[model samples]
Target: MTQPQRDCVIAGGGPAGMMLGYLLARAGLAVTVVEKHADFFRDFRGDTVHPSTITLLAELGLREKFLALPVTQLCTLDAVVEGERMTLVDFGVLRAPDNFLVLAPQWDFLDFLAQEARTLPGFDLQMDTEAIGLLRAPLDQDAGREDAQGTDSAGDVLGLRVRSAGGDQQIHARLTVAADGRTSALREAAGLRAVESGVPIDVLWFSLPKPSEPPPATLAYVSSAGMVLTIDRGDTYQSGLIIKKGAFPAMQQTGITEFRTRLVAAAPVLAGVADTLTEWEQIKLLTVQINRLLRWHRPGFIAIGDAAHAMSPMFGVGVNYAIQDAVALANAITPQLRQGVVPERTLAGVQARRERPVKVMQAIQGRGHRVIARATVGQRVLSLGAVRLLRLGSPVLRRILARVVGVGLLPEHVRTPPGGSR
Candidate 1:
């Protein structure tokens, strides 16, 4: 069957794609989103919405909705290093309104976005549709003669032929967005190469028993091996074990008690809650690869979110960055489209507008991963230095740390809003 042509088609209904759909549709562009999964699961994915992203959410008219969600406000990140506990960073220094990270489940956020997108005028959310390949007919000027005669003369994107439960269907759009995640099929089809540099730390996400009593804001225990991020989720605390790439399985096999012991050895204060630990089978381990695609846009297609850049889990900033990309892409191109510019030309504006922020985020994530990967001696120095520097509360240090927490003082290019795309 043939799907109606749209102004834009976004593959992968993750945060970025959904937000992009909302933005474009709000701008009166017919947009359709294809997702392989029929249902949004409760995956333990990104939950940290940095202060920078908070600011962006306000710009998108989503602050009130996002704030209404059950979220934990993470004001500061405390680091326990070599038995010394210190508030290594405080997000409070960022500008008013959005001064800290908002901790909420990505599933809840995406679901809210999906619900919101349904009410928009020009939006279509197609679930259980999988993109198999890019449908590009080698620019044949002769082939589009029929389309040229039609009211929509630009011929734009012919969209994608996707596999679905019913059968095969062709989704037509002026632009196709790839938000299909780190290993993106659309990006692969576009022949976009990913340039990656491995970070020193890999993260293992494991679920422990939900604490009877709630936890602190956010905990970062930096050790010679790596760091563990105790991210606060309203109902449960998500513990991310950042360790050497090869260390997770061995640690998992050591069983709960031993794992608890090791965790306590690194940060004794968390030992009290160790007994609540449950199964590790559901634990998801991700190799920290700080990678970026050399090209974000190719012809009628553009990749967003993890599809374009997959950053290390060191600072929990990837989701926020992806949301920023959605906003940038939408803001830069919608007005251009409204003014009758061709889709390809409008996408160029999107690419140009997004280039700086992508680079800035890549650079920051790279440096952060390096700090996480520093040797024991180096980590000790870094930990102690961070403690000492933080104590000063100097203007420069405040500004720098604010940037680290995604409250970057750089122009709008570098600042992403804090709320999830609501």
Candidate 2:
């Protein structure tokens, strides 16, 4: 069967893929986004939409609509370390209008983008379709040999072979983006190598009913028992219990009641719902990973977000970084895409612009992993130094930390034109 052709074909409908698709479509470039999932409903996905992301939404004039969705604004990041409550990062100091981390389910955010993208004449979204491999045109063919600059090029990628409920099909495009996430099949098929950083901890995520009254803005608890992070989700608290890496299986052998007991002991705040966790099936394991590709692009394709770099969940910046990647990609490629050719240099430029921030953020997350590993092994207590710094250092220190988490090292902005609203 003859495959439909588009200006760009994006694999995976996560933040990176969907946002890039929306931006390209808005720029008047035909784009098709393929998602393996039929719907964007998933438990325990990154729900923290950082200030950086909020800024991008505003740039596209979708801030009000995006904020209309049910979301909780986290203005201050507090934590219970060694039984003492300490304010670590204060988002209130940021000068932006929405100077706080917006906690909304990732699905709502993606759905919002998908709906907005549909308004553009050039946008096409195919749900329940998974990209299986690349559709490569022979390099010898003159039509297939053109580079991003319309010059002769090697390693030309033509499109994607995708599978859906209907069956297998092909999608041809001038450019293909691998934004399918950390375990991207396309990245692997392209033989891009990613350097992995060993993580010493894993997270067990679960949810409990929210307390009738407002909970503390604090999101983390570090005690002799272990480390726990909780985000207030309006009606419930989404929680992550940090356990030693590779220890979950052994911990599971001990039984669910003991696990529940340990959870209550670690964070007394969760005692109310401790008993609600009667079965092990209620918990989901998130195997923490930190890694980045040495190279983020090839002749016909480029990888963004977790496809290029997978971050540790320590700071909940994974989603934020992915969104940033989308913005950078759009800013760099939209003009070329509009011209009907995307140079290999342009693809490499996207990676060059975004790599530094990825490196810096991953280093911070790596240090966090080491700290958590030490606490899990009882090798160290919650650093009183961190508490001292926050206490003695004026609001300046808090603001600095907040800026780091809220906006990241170098944030990207929307550069593409905003299309008509639906």
Candidate 3:
């Protein structure tokens, strides 16, 4: 049987894959996205687009549509320190045209991307298709390849093997992209080494009724509240409590009353909804861990998003970095297509261009986890001082913190497309 062919075959349909598909399709590449899930929309995932992502959406001509959705402008971030609450970071200081971060549902953003992506001419975004294998096209040096015959310029991508209801199928492409999440099959299949470090905190997420009065902004609890957080969900306030990994099982066994007791202990204001709690089933627990790939790419394939690096949720930087990876990948690969070739150097360049910043972010996020995990009084005092210094240290600190909350302004690699220095 003849092998199926496409310009680019992408695995996974999360934000990273969708964003890459959107841009590649817009750039006139034949792009097919294979997502395992029948329906792409799911809950209990990252929602906020960060300030930088919002800027990218505007660049993509979807900001107005994004804003039109039921969303809020998050202007502040508060944390409880030493039994006293204070602002840790404020989005209001972000120097973007839209200074506030948008609060909406992740599914809402997915709907927006799906609706917009379907309209592009070159896009074949397929749902319910599970990618199972990566196929390496016979390199020119391989025997019997003399007859396989490469195209005049556009090289055949390393191929892919997929599973569907009909049967196992094979598809080939010039570029195979792995946008799968942290537990990425593609990443493992590619033989990439990934290192994951568990943070000291375990995150438990549950929904409660909106406070009778909403809090000033997103809320965080220092070590005193078990380093938990209560964030402003669109319709309700969602709380994330950090607890010992061993403690969760006991909490689960004790049931709702015990759970609410723990919650009230973290933030007393949440007690109002504690009584109204209908189902604890809505509560989900995630083991907070950070990971990074030894390398981001190989000869015919590349991994992006959580596949490349997984960061702790301490600063909520995971989604921002994932989307940024999509942007960087698109910008780097688009030029190679125009050149009418997909050289090994080009693939290597994408990995090299992206890896440094990825390491930088991983380091920064790891440090944050260390600071938050510190239980020493002196360290706690230093942490408080650090927050204060972040606010008043200098114009640079203010700018960095502003963007960190809202998203925008960063190292050159994150700011401009690779090779765009020209």
Candidate 4:
């Protein structure tokens, strides 16, 4: 069977992949997004949509519709440290209108994008379709050669070797994007390696029913005993207990009673509430990681989001960064893609533009690893003097954090030619 070549074929229907497909199809280009999963109903994906993302949605005329979804907003990112309340990020300080952290389920967010993208004539989304490998043009019997402009200068990437319910087949395109995430098989097939940073903690995720009188609405509650990140999800509170890396096996050996004790100690608000969690099966482990690729592009191929940089769950900025990458990519390459084959320079430009922002965010997250490690290991993270200093400079710190976390650095807008409604 013959497969029609598209303007772009994106592997992994993640935020980066879906958004890029939408933007390109909006620009009147044929684009397809492939997802391994049958649907987008996964638990515990990053659910925080920052002010910057909300602003972009507004540019796409999606702000009102997106906010219409069942979502909660957090005006401030607060943390309770050693019984002292500190506001980490004050979204009110940001310039973006209605600046707030919108907490919506990842599935709802993805579905919303898919719904919008499907209305565009050129957008195609293939669910339950997984990319098995990369399709590369043979180097004329020579091993490898290069051109002057980008990473893989030989126009090596053809498209993707994808497998679906119907079986394996090839999808050819002028450009291929690997938005397949941190454990990206496409990234490995493209032979791009990401530099891994040492992460000292992992999160134990579980759900507890929303108490009749719920605790304060804050990002996290911390103490010498441990740290619990509280996320309000309507009827239930999706809570995460940060623990030292590789500690799950030992903690499992120790039993569920010890786990409940740590949870209660972190947030005394849930003191007697954790007693219901008697079984280990209810808890899910999320291995925390922080990594970034040295080069995000090669010839007709490029990577974005977790596929390019695996973010630590510090500020829940992973999804935000991925969305930015997609916008940047479409903005940079649309004109040339509309012309036909995209030169490697266009792909490289997207990486160059987004790399620095990702680096800065990851560095900040790296700095946080120490504090989180100490907190998870039952050490006092904030001193009396430190708390006083925070009190004195909190306003300044709060505004600064708001700008970085809420609006981010060098936020991109939609610049591609607008898509038409079906």
Question: Pick by TM-score: which candidate is best?
Answer: 4
If scored against the real structure, what TM-score would every candidate get?
0.85, 0.94, 0.85, 0.96
lDDT tens readout by residue for model 4, 227-315: 89988888778889999999999999999998898788888888757887989999999999999987888878999999999999898
Q: Give per-residue CA lDDT, model 3, range 213-288, as digits (tens).
A: 7666656766444455777776677667767555677777888787777677666767677677656677788877
Clashes of each: 8, 2, 4, 0
Better of 3 and 4 by lDDT: 4
Give the worst 10-residue stretch by lDDT in candidate 1: 146-155
Let me know the TM-score candidate 1 reaches against the reference structure.
Answer: 0.85
Model 2 lDDT tens row, 1-422: 44778889999999999999988898888899999999999899999999998998898889999998988887888888788787878888887697888999989999999999999889999999999999876656444344443333455688899999888999999899999999998987776789999898999999987655545866888866788888888778899888899888988999998888888878888887778788779999999999998788777788999999999887789998998998998888877777778798998888988999999999999987887787677654556686566467747767888889998999898877754322
Per-residue lDDT of 187-259 in model 1, one digit per residue for the tens? 7777667888766667777655445654455477766644566776655568876666677777877886776
Better of 1 and 4 by lDDT: 4
**Which ten residues in a row are the worst by lDDT in model 2?**
144-153
TM-score of 2: 0.94
